[model samples]
Target: MMDSLEGEELCYPLLLNVSCRGLMRPRFEAILLYTLFSSITVLTVALNLMVIISISHFRQLHTPTNLLLLSLAVSDLLVGVVVMPVETVRFIETCWLLGDVMCALSYIIGFTLTSASVGNMVLISIDRFVAICYPLQYPNKITRSRIEVSVCLCWACSFLYNGLILKDHLRQPDRYNSCYGECMVVINYISGTVDLVFTFIGPCSIILILYIRVFIVAVSQARAMQSHITAAAARKVPVTAKKSERKAARTLGIVILVFLMSFCPYYYPSLAGQDISNDASSWAIVSWLLFFNSCLNPIIYAFFYPWFRKAIRFIVTLKILEQGSSQANIL
Candidate 1:
């Protein structure tokens, strides 16, 4: 009878182990995708950091817009640093080894930096729109103090809202939803729902509306410029400044397009939720795509800015010369 009881007791864990092992196929595929995605993201992040550092170190690129670009680069770099590393580890292993405390820290840091970056983008978009449309008032309206205050407010809001999650939660074992594995590590279903609304839906809606208004305003400005040029020619005046404004508008449009492309995949999975099958393969693909955003910014620069190519060339040359010198010294 004792031997019979032992056999029954062993059967339960054995069954569970087999079931969990069956789930491993999808998880293994996810690990491969995470590896590829994280590699690319890290490379892109490295390039962005170089660009930001080089620009700041070289005084020639010190325009207000470049300053904003620098800020965006910093935020993107932080996302790669604070969010992607832990996320990649979790996705690949299908577990969270960092415990609840670290997971909470990851949650807060990632949320705050990403939100701040998004907020800064909105502010920069408005600044560009105003600068192009109302050149006379732009200087007075967008002073250094005002920009600083706006940046501070963005940070403050990000911290307060993201920090709200940290208050009531810790890495306690009770909070772990073993069913979802690492997917439910940092947050539960209820908090995850809240995160989806606040982080993805709310911010995305505001950005979309703002960008729409910006596009409309840009169209109107173009029409006005065409009319102004016709009147200027009649009055025998030059229209050189309008041409410059048009070039800047084109650059801004490209930036907006890149931002949308990079962020869409990241938010799509959250919006899809359980409807998307919660299967490992689909989740892995979406997760990697989102992580791709950190790396996409560097690609954006290469596509849109000739200066970035020059910067890359400079970096390569420097590295080659440094390596050559090291070899000579070793010899």
Candidate 2:
């Protein structure tokens, strides 16, 4: 008979000597938590799928900005489809059932998606900065082809950079395992510090700087509009220009804010000069916090962007399946 401590059990009872222990929770609590997390995984996949289909299928929505959004949705969708399920299992079971190869692959996918997200955010910040601060030059500078190339470069760089960062773990997935049923990876201080600068601090700095400039320009334009309102009222002038810029600024600002919130907690250990360990209980919470951002992104779009709402309506009603639907004027 297998020995048990209280209600706890070994992950691999037959190989008890090499097995890692699993946390035992009450049956009701385990069921409830599983249901909750499964629901989030489903919702995240569905929301990002809507974004992907809306952007890809609709010809009218195929702008440079929307392309960038499509890229983001792809990363977010992978988070739901690939990362979240595995992570859910990891957190809930508290032991690794999958073999060593899978362990390394999971982390690679997670890091790649994360890096891609940051890259997409940076591209979006630049897009908005140019649109709001230099409206006239935006048309000439931000072309569809250029944006496509940039998105490809962003993804390619993310794959390359993360591969380099996790190269050793990929080479030896079982190196950090304490027993047969454990999955973990350790980054040395030097490697961790380098990753911190490139992946976290550097990209965040660029995003913040660009958005600040955008914000300043947006404020100045708002004030100018206020000043002109009285004078322009006599001439029946249109505030369309000011309204568009302000709206774009507001939407992107919310995106940046949410991104920061999702990412900061995950990196807190690094910022505090602590080694990131997957075995820590706090790791589960922080990892899920980061993953939850994917779910919130489509919610943000649904709330802020009218086109997304219209697209969702069409998608839900199956209007998108009709012939020549791509030409439908969603904008």
Candidate 3:
């Protein structure tokens, strides 16, 4: 009985000397957590997959902005498919059973998806900035081909940047492990600081600045539309186009706000001049908050974008499988 009890406490009981401790959550709590996170994983994947199909299958939805949304959905889909499952096991089990190589790859995948998400947000903000601030020039400035190239660059840069940052971890997966059943990576102070600036601070600064400008321009345009003189003078302007731009700006604005809220806590340790430790007590909560952003994104789209609703209806009803459905007017 004592041996069994002791064995239960170790993640790898046969190698007790090198094993990390097993999590000891109450049965009820463990079940609840598993249910909750599993739902999130499923929802995130399904919702983002819907977004992917909606954008990709509909010819009418192939705008430059929607292409960026598609890129963002792909990154979110990866988070749901790859990062969330592994992270759920890591957090709930509180021990690594997947081996050192899997550990390194998980961290790399997580970082790459995160970086790509941030990159997509930056691109979306720039797209909105151009649309709102220079509506007349938006078409010429942002094209389908340009957006495609930019999306490719965003993903490629994410992979290259994260690989560079986590090169040591990749090469020596067990370098930071103190025991066989502990999966963790440690970033040195210098590299951590650089990552903080580049990944969080720099990107966030650009997002905030561009969004602030977008907000200012949108507000001014609203006020201008309300003015009789400005409205009459610009009567030749396409009101429908202006309304579309304003609506898109509002939807993307909410996305940026939610992203900022979800990610801020995850980086609080870095902001406070502390090394980011994956094993910290609050790490799981903050990390989940960040991951939860991926799930929330598709929900935001559903709530804000009418086309997404129509697409979901068509998708769920099997209408998308019909011939020539791709050319159906989704807008």
Best by TM-score: 2
Model 3 clash pairs? none
lDDT of 1 by residue, 1-331 (tens): 6654442322124445421221233656776877786777678688678768555644455556666667667777888877787767755654445655676676568668777777767777677667756779998988767777777788888899877755654435325444323334334455556766776666666656655566666666665665656653744332444554566556656666666665666555455563222244655566555556556655554335565555556556674245333222110
Task: Count clashes in each candidate, considering only residues at least 3 apart in sequence or on different chains.
Answer: 1, 0, 0
In candidate 1, position 126 carries an lDDT of: 73
lDDT for 11 in candidate 3 is 76
Indicate the residue-level lDDT of 30 in model 1: 78
Report the lDDT tens digits of candidate 2 across residue range 152-225.
99999989988998899999999988888889987766767777888778888998889888877876776677
lDDT of each: 0.60, 0.84, 0.85
Supply the TM-score for candidate 2: 0.91
Clashing residue pairs in candidate 1 are 100-171
Error of 3 at 302 (Å): 5.5
Q: Which candidate should be chosen as best, given lDDT against the real structure?
A: 3
- Scored against the true structure, residue 28 in model 2 reaches a CA lDDT of 94
How well does model 2 score by local distance difference test? 0.84
lDDT of 3 by residue, 1-331 (tens): 6665553677788996888777477789889999999999999999999999999899998899999999999999999999999999888886788988999999999989988988888898899889979999999999999999999999999999999989999999998788889887877677777888878888888888887888777767765655644546567555654785677567657866787788888777777777777868898898899889889877775447789999999999999999999988878
Supply candidate 1's per-residue lDDT for 267.
54
Candidate 3, after superposition: displacement of residue 100 in Å?
A: 0.4
